[model samples]
Target: MNDADAQMIARRVREELARRRLSRQALADMARVSISTLEKALSGRRAFTLATVIRLEQALGVPLQKIPAASPADPLVASPDNLGAYSQNAVRWLEGRYLTLRPSFGTPGDIFAYVTIIQWDAEQGCLVFSEAERLDSSFSQSGKVSLPHLSGHIYLVTNVEGQYRLAVLGRPTIQGALYGILTTLMVGHGSQLIPAAAPFVMLRLKAETEIAFGRIEANHPDYVRYRAELDLVTSDGFAHFPK
Candidate 1:
């Protein structure tokens, strides 16, 4: 890696460490690397090997590739006019960790709660999103905003299972909440791709809320509440109806 790449990795490491409240020693222990080695990489005194990078990724629960490097050519920062394409207020409103609600696999009435993080991707000139359970260090999917005409904002994210999924987050309501639809590509027995969609909602969590790392089991209290909220949205016909 070049010096720029090394610095990018270092910055990402620091961000993750702060977000997860992990100490350098804690990360070194988790990655099975010496404190000195971790220090050297973070200090930019040494570059990380591929194997070491993987270890750090696992320890940090962040995909290093998702972290963009600093570049002056980024249009989002370089051109003021670019901001007019999307609402800065909406951008600020949408960026953060949200507790997302979706239908449970094979259980129509059941709902699953997953944590999703959204951030501005300056290089891509769009919002980048990732979803994961608290216990899972790796993101289950990565998505980016898709532009053009739309009644609401649309995101095209690729699931870890290699399926393409689309999420449409509607404009902020008076209540300051975003309701949307989640569409997944379903493969039929004949190898045809069918779009199956479900109505869902996302509520931004308070920064102080303790985020659990493991999957939210059906028996969890949040599951019932999430299902109830989603059911309400579907019943009220508030979710985006994709034509």
Candidate 2:
């Protein structure tokens, strides 16, 4: 890779590590490499080989290509026209219904699969999503949009409650599935917002027929079936999805 590309990769790696709250030693173990080797790569003292890159990608639950390249300018702080362009691009890619795989609160080894609908909010100039079945409910919801940066485009989403659940969505893979890391700002011991992060993925469910949304509850049989079809992976296995 060129120097610019190498720098970009380093930035992406550091960001991913921070987002997932992974220690260098932990990532080295997961990647089956020594901590020193990983450090050298990160520090640009050693170039990353294809094999090493693949291993790191697998370990981090992120594709190397999904990590954006460094940008020449800050996209979010640009002119109104530039911002509009970024928002439009984001809306086009993200405005749709998705079956989200969320960590199940009651079951430690399972995921909660539910339908969510994303619509464009003209006033907000961003895309908003809510539980497809519970459109009128008071539960917190998330919105997503495209943000421009040196690396091209990044998708950011947030759900507001007492704090916020923010996630950065990666590029879709060959199977059209999306994966990314989630971080939440929560009230801590001192009534301050502390951030915690985890990885997640969302798969698009075929919408040939209208889906029944609001009727499915946590204890419902359909909910059980949905969970059954979804293969629950450990936090480190966030990027893996069953076809």
Candidate 3:
């Protein structure tokens, strides 16, 4: 979205919040967001979330459909296994490891998320690495330096603590492609992917390559079974949905 669009959305939210005599804190509480997050939305520093927008609309009895926000139907989802080959290569490079892949999840706003895990093998005594670096290498080979088709920026969570403390890394790319990947994944899964309802997935690895385990809630079903296999068949070992 452009600056003007963001400004309009923020103004609408602020106006509605004020018309309802709802304090910023109250509105944030109702929307289940941090006060700072609400501030960012109101200040036009960040795009309003789908849930937050809906809540604001309902709270003020306004019609959100009239807004110029990006449509949820804007095809952004993509195959979860599109990156399967790259993921496989990373997993193999760090051989002495037990690995797990998660299923892809799609959200209403055309966002897709998936996760994988790598565990150190007791016999190898080596640290296993499966990070964005490997994925970038693969993308370079495919002649695509960035994956904007997946989303403007992909957020990676490095650590989590009781849902309150989490370390996240955001990688920016082409918004259209990112949205396409997310939308396609949702089509393949036929499910609503929301952070509130369905939490984002994350890969688990051991500190110092000790050992790791994949969480059941963090993986896609197809990924665990045939992700690597599917990667082998993707056109040139990479799937380009945006193109």
Candidate 4:
């Protein structure tokens, strides 16, 4: 995530904790997280994971989706003559949705989350989700990245002109498959498909641009497929559907 977006999430998390009159200790206890870990999450010192975000939401009884994100890059500020490389206009776009499900393989278990991007929507004359990627059984040691854990999934999204571009990040996995499906679906009838692979979640699009940002659906179709598979792995109340 960009600094602008990271800061926004951090501020939102802090505000919610305060609004509910929840002290750091109470929050950590309620979320089953350590105080220091909660501090990093709330301060944006660490990458915001869906696992931690959900815990906070449940504790605060609020949704992370409600958090306000910075608007797409501003044109006037994007020109090299007017701004530096670190400006908002130079930042990329990426939206993530995390779902915590039951343990399927190991002691640490797995944390599920879908990472999606804004692919150009030709028919709609804008950008829409090309796909929602999934990390079904990715393990997170002790529910933190400080120790042994998986990279999960990562990709890029860019806002060029009035449209946002999608960049599938490398090789095929459930994540890439989802993006591929979304790219095809969003451009179903008439649309230009520009398939590019980017390193990390960085957008190399032009400076100033705006696009509607977000995933097309609350739970993408692949999620449904994952749920069916998960049912056989974990019994009863362990598995869940996003609400």
Q: For this target, which candidate reaches the highest TM-score against the unseen true structure?
A: 1
Candidate 2 or 1, higher lDDT: 1
lDDT tens digits, residues 174-216, model 4?
2212221011112222564443321122222232433222222
lDDT value, candidate 3, whole model: 0.35
lDDT, candidate 3, 1-243, per-residue tens? 566656777876676666546688876665457899879877777787766666554333233333233256543222123321122211222222212222333223222222233333323222222333222233211111111223322322222233221111122111111111111112243454324222222233344653222322225453333334223223332234333
Give residue 171's error in model 2 in angstroms: 0.7
CA lDDT, every model vs. true structure: 0.64, 0.56, 0.35, 0.37
What total of clashing residue pairs does each candidate reach?
A: 3, 3, 26, 1
Give candidates' CA RMSD values in order. Answer: 15.3, 11.3, 19.4, 17.5
Off by over 4 Å in 4: 66-243
Comparison by TM-score, 2 against 3, better one: 2
TM-score (all chains, Cα) for each model: 0.53, 0.45, 0.26, 0.27
Q: How much does candidate 1 score in TM-score?
A: 0.53
The residue-level lDDT of candidate 2 at 90 comes to: 27
Relative to the unseen true structure, what is the C-alpha lDDT of residue 145 in candidate 1, on a scale of 0 to 100?
A: 55
Residue pairs of candidate 1 with colliding backbone atoms: 134-213, 135-213, 135-214
lDDT of 1 by residue, 1-243 (tens): 777877888998888677656689988876778999999999988888877777776444334543334366545531123222453223444568777777654454656667788887766666678887734354366766543322334454564566567777654443445677887765555878777888867777787876443445667766666667677666766664547
Error of 4 at 134 (Å): 42
